[model samples]
Structures are given as C-alpha cells and as structure tokens.
Target: MDTQKIPSPTLTLPKSLTGIQGLDEITGGGIPKGRPTLVCGSAGCGKTLFAMEFLVHGAMLYDEPGVFFAFEETEKDLAINVVSLGYDLDKLVAEKKIVLDHIHIERKEIEETGEYDLEGLFIRLNYAIDSIGAKRVVLDTIETLFSGLPNPLILRSELRRLFRWLKEKGVTAIVTGERGEGTLTRQGLEEYVSDCVIVLDHRVTEQSSTRRLRIVKYRGSTHGTNEYPFIIEENGFSVLPITSIGLDHTVLSERISSGIPRLDTMLDNKGYYRGSIVLVSGTAGVGKSSLAACFSDAACARGEQVLYFALEESPQQIMRNMRSIGIDLDQWEKRGLLMFHAKRPTFYGLESYLTAMHKAVNDFKPRVVVIDPLSSFIIGTNQFEAKSMIMRMVDFLKINPITVFMTHLTTGVNDFTGIDISSLIDTWLLLRDIEIGGERNRGMYILKSRGMAHSNQIREFRLTEHGVELLDVYVGPEGVLTGSSRITKEAQEKAGQLLRSQEIENKQLALERKRKAINAQIDFLKAEFDAEEVETLNDIELNKLRENLLLQDRIDMARNRKGDIITNKNSINKARGNIAKS
Candidate 1:
C-alpha cells in the first residue's frame, strides 16, 4: 500500500516574553516564538547585552532554558563580562538552565568551496538544545559568518535555510547582526528574520550620551512605535517606559496628610490625594526644602515609610538642617521609617538618574517619596525633556497609593515655578518671598488642587521649631496682615478697645451716682407732702365738729320757744272752753 500523503497542521503564532519589561512593552508581548528576530546595531550599542539578557531572562523569569551561540566572544569572556550585571552564566550553565557555545570562525582557516551547506552549525545547535531542553536560543551576531566565509552566494543560501530550520525546530531565537549601510544588518541579514526586528542606537549630543531601542518591524504583532531608553545598572537592566500614559493605573479617593497640619487644612481637602503628585515651588531660601522636611517629618510621624531623595544636600546635612527646624528626620531614618538617598545631579545622565530612582523606590517600597528640589533634575536637560521624565515618574508612582512631593526652585519674577509641570500636578503649593522693609518674608498659598476646595488667599507662613505654621490671613487696611505690621496693628487695636471699655465704665459709674441722688431727693419730697396732707385733713375735721355743735344748740332753743307759745294759747282757750262746759 502507498503511504498516504500527510499534510502539516496549521501552526498558531506563539509569543515568548523576553522578561525585559520595557522590551516586552515595546514588542506588545514579546518576539514571535519559534522564529528568529533580527537585532542590528553598531559598536557598543548593547546588542550583545540585549541578546544575553533575553536568554538570562528566559531562564530566570520564564523557567525556559536557552542556548546561546556567541560568534565573537568566548564563553569565559562572556561569563566574566556579564558578572557585573548580576548574571552568572556559569551558574546557569551548571544548573542546566542554559548552554553557552562560542563558535569561532576565522577567514584564515576557512576556504570557500563549492556545494557547501551550514548543516554542521545546525547539528551543533540541535544537540545543545536537545541536551538542555532549551526553549530559547540566541545566535549572537550571525552576520560575522560573512566575514569568515568568502562565497556570498552559498552563504546567503545557507543563511536562509538556517533561519527556516530554526523556526521549524520550534524554539524562539534572537539573531544579532551588525548594522549595514542602508539595510538592517551589515550582511543584509534582515531578509531571513523578517518576522521581528529591533534596532539599537547609541548617540551623543551636547556631551550627553543616550541609548535608544526601537522596534524596526514586527510583522504580525502590534507594538509601541516610540523609541524607549534602557540602562544597564548594578542590579540588572531597566527600560524607561516612554508609554506610561493611560487610565490603567489604580486610582484612590482616599487622602494622606501633607505632614503639616495647617498645610493639610489649606489643601481644602482631607489631605493630598493618595497617589497624587504635589509640587512645592518658591524662590531661593523660601522654605521649599523646609516644607519638604515638614512633609517627611509628618509622614514619619504617621509611621509610614518615606523615600527622601536629596539631590543637592548630603543626607547628614539635610538631617542637620531639618533638625534645626525641630524635624528629626534622623530619628525616622533610625526607626527605618524613612530612607535618605542623596546624590549630585551633575554626576549622572538623565537615564541614570531615573534608573537609580526606579531602583531605590522598588527596593525601599515607601508610601511617600520626596525629591527635595526637583530643580536640580533639570540641570543638564531641557524643560520639555525634564518634564516628560517627571510625567513618566508620576505615572509610575501614582499606580499605587504612594504620595509624591517634588520641590521646584523658581527663577524669575514671572515664573512661579522654574518648570511648568503644573498641568500634571494634583496639588500645587506655591511659596512667595515678599520683600518688605529690607526683609524677605515667606508667603504660602495653594495655586491649584484637583477635586478639592482650596484657599486662594496668600498666607504669611513662618518656619518655627515646631515646623511650618500657617498663620491666619490678616486683613488690614493695606491688605493681609503680616510681619511686624500685623503685630503693631493688633497692639494698637487692643489699646483702643481698652480705652473704649474704660470710658464706658466711667460713664456707667457717673450715671449710677446721679440716679442714687435723685432717688434720695424723691423720698424726702414724698415725706414732706405726706405731712402737709395729714395736717390739712385734721383742720377740716375740727371745723366740721364745731359747726355741728352750734347747729344743734340753735335747733333746741327754737323748739322750746314754740312750746311756750302753744301753752299760752292753750290756757286762754281752756278758760273759754270752761265757761261753755259749765
């Protein structure tokens, strides 16, 4: 029976994470799995490091063993060089997590002959992958084979076949190449590994060096179209993600104290919103640093971890200065609630600064982070670039509920803040130096606060031993009260109030005395009138009794007379009647 012709099954494209966060971000997920990606760059662009990190990350982060075929550097040389990055190649090799093969091909030893294929190279790679069960492979700078072999026609044909075979083997691979004149790789190696391509670039402008990584082409994958900066630090590599924008970060409605109770009140809020960015801006010696210290002290008092980034002053110097203001940051440091990271801005590039900051924050894991005077962060960078860096940093920190305070030193009279990151800030506190009577006074007020009520009136603030004291807005004839004028005016007003109070008391005393005298006079007049009334009444009663006696005596006399007359008449009549009776 004839063998049935078998058709191959359809293959789905798989993605393998390179374990580099920024790289993974740029590539969307990672390089296409079981396929080769071309990485081309000129000298010292970290082309080799990129490939090595891919393998190392695969082994460490993904638990996927990798095979590295280095065409330029020997295994011993590679192991020694990567030691600084904290990658131990020897250990990984011993653990059977990786296999390192350094293939040396010299033009002097090889003579190009006819009908030759790269089957030997394929055999070596197959055996290594099978032995270690590597799911990832890196043929570093495979374009070097062009220099070793003279026949271009045969070399090109074999190179195409090699990429195909690697893809067929079902292992993710990184093939590094040197940059060419117009094409991607020096040997025009972009044709074979056309699925995904990355270009590394190193350039110096204005005496500052920056390394940028860009994805030239990702055939079937959506990726970030911007160039991202990467740095190699002590711990490992880090990518300053240029794409930190979105609502993807976690938001919080909760608030935290500004470390200054009065300042918190001025925020017109519960406090600064958790995971919000705060900017304190002022001229020189306007208590910007003092305010930052207060905030740090406040956070420490709450038993919250704080990361203090002192870009200008030494840690001890800052501690000593804050101590004078009654803010004991050293105590917090001792208690392990506060950590101080001090460095000079002039000694490092922007990338290095961000890398250091990122590492410090990750390691420390503080709820509050302070960059004392972010003005120095723009020392060597332009305003736009510095603000961009700050924006990215803010996005990074705001993902958690970590509050950030960055102080900016104002320059001119017009510029309230030296930089214009106000648009990105959640709460902006502006400090002004008011010149009066040949003295500089610090006035503070809130310029803006998102999602909260804030006081607009400027307040005269003083830095005392107890920290920042935001005094009441003294509204006087000239304006708000401040300094000696406020004190003098208050004293004068108090004196006037005392004088008015004394005058009122004297008038009340005089009125009370006059009232008492009048009352005494009224009592005497009433007694005099009562005596007169009693005397008049007695006289009238006596007159009435006398009249009654006289009238009764007269009446008795008249009755007696009348009775005598009647008797006389009766006697005469009686005589006449006696004669008639007889």
Candidate 2:
C-alpha cells in the first residue's frame, strides 16, 4: 500500500476599484486604495466625470463619503449640472456624504505680496475632509493653480507636497489636469500624482466626435491600459471598459414580434431575438417611426413594458401624430404598458441623454426599448461620440436582455445616407421611399440579421390607419421592383396582364359553350334527314329537305365565326365531303 500527497493550488488576486458600473470589472476593482490617481485630459474629455463617478459611486454604493474641490465651476453650478444626470449632488451635500468646495483661484483674488506656499489649499481641504469624514477626494483641474499662482517652482513643489499630504491623510484621491503635448498634464502634473495616471481624450475624426479614457499608469495593481469609451449621462457618467468578461455576451432566448405580420415573417418565424438591436435606417418620410411604434405596440400588446425615446418629436406630438397612423400610444400609456420620453437632442449633452435613458430603463424595466431616431444625438456629439454612445447603449441593452429598436435618418429619397452603425446591430431594417412615375411608395427590406435566416426580398409596405401593413413583394418581368417609379410601373404592368388574361379566358369559355350547342343542332338535323329520306321523292319534299339542311349549315357557320374557326372549318369540310359521297 502507498500513500500520495496532493499539492495545494496557488491563487493570484487583483486589487482594484469597481465602484463605477462596469469599470470595476475592467480595472479588476477600484483604483489601488490610498494612491493619488492622476486623471488628465483636454477640455470635455470626461476627466471630471470619471473622477466624479468614482466618488459618487463610492458614497452611494460602497458607503464611502467623498470630497470634490472644483477649480473652475462653482459648487452650485456643479450641483445643477449633475442634477439632470440623475445625480443628487444637493442631497449628497445636505447629508454630509459629499463636500463640494468651489475654490475660486482668480488672479485678482490673491496678491503676490510675499513668498508663500499652498497652505491655504491645505487648510480648505482639511476642513472639507473633517466636515464630511470623506474617504475619496477629487481636485477637478488641479492644474488651475499653476495658472493662478505666481511662482511655478513653488507651485510644483506644493503640488508634490499635496500628494504626500493626501497619502498621509489616508484618503484615496483623484487629481485632474489638462493634457499637454508629450506630457500627462499641461504643466506635467503627472510628475507629482505619479502613483497612477489616466488620460481622457476627445477627438473629432471625419466629423465624428469621440471621448476615450486610458489608464497610462496604475502603480501597484494590474489594470487595463486601453482607451475605453465613456459617456456623460443624466445619472453622471459611465465608462464602457473593454474586457474579456461574459457580462456583455448574454444571449436572450425570448422573441418579440415587430407588429406587422409580414415584417415579422421576414424576420423568420415571428420577430427579432430578445436583447437584439434593430436599426431601421431610411431617407425622409419613409414611415420609419410608424414602423417602430408598431413594433413597440406589438410588444406592449403582449403584456411587455415598452419605453419609447423620441428625440425628434415631443411626447404629446408623437402621440397625436401616431394617432393618424392608427398607433394609440396614449392608450398604451393609460394601460400602463408603454412610456414615452421625448426631448430634443440639442437640449442637453450626450451624457445627459444617456443618463435619462439609463434612468428610464432602470425605472421602467421594459422588455422593449425604442429610440425613434438616433441620428439626432449626433447633432450634439461628433461621429465618434455618436458611435460610442450607440455602442455603449447596445452593450447596456444586451446585458439586460432587452430588445432595442432605433431609427436613423438618411439623405435622399432612394439613397441611403450611410451612417456607420450597421456593424454593431443584430438586425438592420432599411426603409426607402422610391419615386415612381411621379408617385412615392415605401419599400422595406431586412439588410442583415445575425444568427438567423431572413428574407432577402424587399417587401412593399404602406402606412394605414391601422398601422404599417406589408404588401406582397413587387414582381415583374424585370424582377423585384425598387424605388417609387419601378414599383408603380410594375404594379401597372401586372394589373394590365391580369385583365387581358381574364378577358381572353371569358371569351374562350363562351365560344366553347356556343360551339357545343350548334353541333348538337346539326346532329339532330342529319338524323331527321335520314329518317325522311324515302318520303322525300317529290319536288316539294326535296325542296323542303334542301332548305332545312341549308338552315342547319348556316347556324353552324354562325357558331364558328364567334371564336377561332380552324377547328370548325375542318369539321365543316369533312361533313360536306361525306354529304357529297352519300
């Protein structure tokens, strides 16, 4: 007998911060505890948002109160700005859970009378921490001190001292700075907050604006060093960290219909998969919204909650307009099945809209979400932000397993404007208005449906009072029709052909019936002639028989004239030959 010993497995753990929604999963957790993290970026790169979200989530979710020292905007302005984002900055202030100090470092407010240090900043910061008993602190745009103070050397030294002091105070701090060429911050603030450095960038590419965040350095813990897309929303900000986690790969098994039976049929069986993103892009006046509302209504009819985010129209206007097309969204709202949130995209920043959406999704817990038109969001943001927002929104929906339907505005009647969101969607439905023979007709087609077989045919659709109804596909000698003119021409040709065929069929049947009657009459006449043959020897009798036979032949001739006479002519010739032989 022998005994064996098994070796123990070794474990490696990552220490980090996870307070910001999906960020912790990316950073392995929150930033390394008690380290001064540097967040540097150009203006509007979301540096403040990144820092604020960390602190807000820390206080609200993890029970860690925080302090925010603003170097630019006042405390009141910051509170008001973040209020619409679903962040209760005022309440957090009232509860002493957060301390917001608007440090106005105006050049005129301070005098360069004598040699001094940033002892005033130290006192203010200490008072704030003592008042709130905070664990997290954020100095938004700490580089402002460099611009306000007179001595660069003293400012540099004081910055280094501030970092040391924060570490000694045992507060996990984030110091924001403006980005400079070839350096982390404009004044090289990264030299002091060197424990961890993050850079946020907002750039315009091909007219599209995008915001990206990257962790340039994380001192002790392992962290993702890639630039991630983040958004500022009504609830504050959300960073979409790219990771290998399965949280964004959830598969939804449920299916929802698109309201129109034909459209649903085009999608295979019924409709798209739950959690799938459906993009409906088309030129102007193609019934895109009508189609979207129809789908939303269908989901609501099935007892599923539906949230409609209408960016192009007001909620009341949308309800009124949809009524003309037979979509009673107000009724659905009354039944507690549908909710409509409509606002102008230019009314707020992209982050605010996203936060509103987040709130709507959270509060409504809808199974189906619809954005009447996503193109409007592009107005405030550049192409990059548009893409990032769309991607983040899609990811958010995927994780929740909610079906999302979005509409996009395109140019030209027949031409697609070509927005580059197709790659991120699960199904793309293109609606086009085709001009045919001075008339406009709408056509719909499923451009792509991932993981499912869909109809490749472009189907004809019409907006009616009952909603969008898909008609049979346009068929003609030249194949399927597109645009307005082609559809009209094909429809006309089809109607003409159908009419001609029907008329010919009717005439042929009438002639056939008449021909049979005439044949029967001739046979009876022949039988009479045969029966009376012996009695017809006299002139009078012969004359009567001849006249009667002539009359019978005339009736047969009349019947042949009504239709194709070839068959009747051959029969008549054979009969005459028989009579002559007899």
Report every candidate's CA lDDT. Answer: 0.82, 0.79
lDDT (Cα) of model 1: 0.82
Candidate 2 lDDT over residue span 27-122, tens digit each: 666676776888888888877778878888878887889999999889888888677657898899898899999888778787887789989899
**Tens digit of lDDT per residue, candidate 1, span 433-533?**
77654566778988888989887878888989877788865676777667776777778889999999999999999999999999999999999999999
Q: Give me the overall lDDT of model 2.
A: 0.79
Q: Which stretches in model 1 have alpha-carbon errors above 4 Å? A: 1-14, 181-183, 245-255, 268-270, 273-275, 333-338, 362-365, 391-402, 413-420, 436-439, 450-452, 475-481, 485-582
Residue-level error in angstroms, candidate 1, position 501: 10
TM-scores for every predicted model: 0.76, 0.63
